[model samples]
Target: MRIMMLKGFLVAALLLGTSLSHAKPLVLSSLKPLTLIAQEIAGTAADVDTLLPESASHHDYPLKVSDYSRLQKADLFVWIGPELESFLQKPVANLPATKILTAYDLPGLFWPDEASVSDDHHHAKDPHLWLDARNAVTVARAITEKLIKLDAPNTDLYRKNLQVFASKMHELDNRLLAQMKPASGVGFAVYHEGFAHFVSHYGLRQLDYITFTPEQKPGAKHMQQLRERLSKDGSCLFLEPYNNLQATRDLAQELHLRIGTLDALGTQSTKTYSQLLEQMATDFLTCLTNVRH
Candidate 1:
């Protein structure tokens, strides 16, 4: 009788342990870069995942059934909001306001020049706020504060992580600024205008963008105008991994322009926010400064 009773208690204990292990708060970010930021703050206290795959386009993502299910179960949902991921607005609307975080809503976001805003896209704000490290610090603090409230037991850990993140970002900010200093006057073009935050942060010069969104093809007249403009003064054309590479390549070749690749999503970097920023800086320097004239 005693042996049988001990066996039952052990099985119950095992089951309880499994249940507890699965109870970690799940944080779902709309994009990989935001996922990295959430993971850095959440650490082992919560489970963090990105809703969109690395290959998916953030500008025009179609929601799947599984995405809805995931959002329904999420303890927190982080996204760039409707300006970037309009498809998520309806699904996220169903979630409690406390459970949803919009990156663009964070304070100290960089807005593009009024004159530069595209009428075609009709976007009031630049959704790529994460590219700026200062903005990223704001995002990390917001995530940490929310996670601390959700997981009180892990408050100390979350605060500690936030401090570490802030310190590292401060150091990285100076380092990246120095690294980008030489490339300040270098003229570069992009497939999309998503790099405004990055360029404005480091004072780099961007010639122009082929399109506001990658999916939109430049009309023949626009392409001819771009070719003419680029032929006279363009230094290099930077393309994103998800952009229409063939079109970019054709445009680059037509103008005899140097080509460089920038991955704003941090898809190619290790699963860390700092590494993503470093990788972007490296990509910019390597392509913009290293390419022979």
Candidate 2:
């Protein structure tokens, strides 16, 4: 009877251990940039996942029932705040306060040049804060702080990973600043206003843009006005990989100006968050300089 009891106890203990090991850490992100930064701080110890796909426009991203389900499972949720992804507002508010972190709340980041027009939930602030390497540093630190608090047992590991992430981010910021020094205020325009964060950090100027949101394409009248603006000062149109390529191309052709594609949201191969910033800086600088000459 003693042997049989011991065997039963051992079996139960083994099963419980397996169950605990299989339980995953809950992490949810609303954007690709946050997803990448969370993964770095999470350090293989958490299940970091993103809600947005590569091609979805944040301006009109449709929220689904599954998104709410995903949020329910998250121990912590990271989002760009209501300015960028207000679609998540209702659901996120329904979540317990302890479970969500908004990157917009972070300090030491610069707002868009036109504050009155920024954060309007319409044609307003550029939601692409990750494009600014310095902002990414703030985001990574926030992620690390949250992860350490939630997963104290692994605090040391999170700290170490965050340090590595921040170092790489700083390096990228320096690179971007150096590369854009010559192009500052050269005045390029974009099909959309997403480049505000990028240009704001580098001290570059955007002569004009269609709008902050990609939901509404400019009408013919607005297009003519933009053309007139560009005609007076030969400026290149910055395009995004996921935007209406043909329209932008046509605009470029019509005005006889150069056009370049920017990957505001990094790719699967972007791998790390820092690489995304480097890519944007390099691409923008190259595009602007080529057009100038």
Any runs in candidate 2 off by more than 4 Å, and if so which?
A: 1-24, 115-125, 291-293
Displacement of the residue 65 alpha carbon in candidate 2, Å: 2.5
Candidate 2 per-residue C-alpha lDDT over 1-293 given as tens digits, one digit per residue, 9 for 90 to 100: 99999999999999999987556567899888888888988978888998878788876688788877988988899998998787888889999988888988788876666642222345555667777777877888888888877778888998999889788877777877887887775556786777778877788767777655677777777677667777777557888777755876887888777787677778667887877877776777777777432
User: How many clashes in each structure?
Assistant: 0, 0
Each model's lDDT comes to: 0.83, 0.77
Query: TM-scores across all candidates?
Result: 0.89, 0.86
State which candidate has the highest lDDT: 1
The 10 consecutive residues of candidate 2 with the worst lDDT sum are 115-124
**Residue 35 Cα positional deviation in candidate 2, in Å, after optimal superposition:** 0.9
Clashes of 1: 0
RMSD of 2: 3.6
For candidate 1, the per-residue lDDT at 283 reads 80
